[model samples]
Target: MLERLFESTLWNSRFIVILAVVFGLIGAVILFAVASIDIIVTAKYVVATYLSGTHPENFHQDVIGGIIGAVDLYLIGVVMLLFAFGLYELFISEIDVAKESEHDETQLLAIHSLDQLKDKISKVIVMVLVVGFFQKVGYTQYSGALDMLYLALSITAVSVGLYFLGKVGK
Candidate 1:
């Protein structure tokens, strides 16, 4: 009887995962909210600058960089959401609302195994990195042919990685 009780308790310990699921969701919500605020601020800045009829140095670059940064945050938030959903489904229970949804897109959050969850999270992370790379590139000044060549090589590498990533989904 003691052995069975211990076994039952050990099995029930999986409920601890609920903490991670809840906190991950909270983190995702915070990230999404911050990203939205960033975009709103960027929009206001652009509108104010145009209305003032004064284009600051690196104005376009700044605008693009801000938007790209927000995209990066949003992608990271997506990763957090996927993590939470996967953990909950794997440990707790299937989300009833998602299962009931007629929209095929809801299946994106359905995770059947650890590998599937990892793949989904990694893909979103790659997107975040790509966005961050572009955000950094936007602010970089190319001073010479060698710099331009390096930039081209880096972009080619990113493109190749994305191509392979896409093939993995197929």
Candidate 2:
């Protein structure tokens, strides 16, 4: 019994790691794209500013903070994303196992359910983020461009979620 318990604990640890990695890959891909965009935009701005021979006060501060914060957020998101993905996978696994014993077609059904779950979660996050943006802007000033950026990021996240749902669940 002691040996059996040890084995089970070891197995669970490895299983958790595998699940974390699976989701981390997708999360990393998204973060990589975002980081690349930031780098390109910032590089252009920095070069243009230097070339113009004008020192914008506090410009260095924004550039440094932006670079650091962008990476930090992506890293944090990776950790969180992995945990969320593991939970999502556990649910999908449970459905797969439960249906396997009864049905000739379990994968397809499980995939559909998982896809729907992903889309629903993505929509909820987007809604909340948009509402927060509106609240933030309301307290200060409003910018149409902010709205557009929020919309674009939300759509991108949803699209990526859809792709993963099809890959893992289907």
**Residue 45 lDDT, candidate 2, scale 0-100:** 80
Candidate 2 lDDT trough over 10 residues, lowest sum: 133-142
lDDT (tens digit, per residue) of candidate 1 on 1-170: 99999999999999999999999999999999999999999999999999999999989998998899999999999999999999999998999999889999888999999999999999999999999999999999999999999999999999999999999967
- Candidate 1's C-alpha runs over 4 A off are none
lDDT tens digits by residue: candidate 2, 89-117: 55434544646577764433233354554
Which candidate wins on TM-score? 1
The candidate maximizing lDDT is 1
Report the Cα lDDT for residue 145, model 2.
93
lDDT of 2 at 58: 62
Candidate 2's error at 24, in angstroms? 6.1
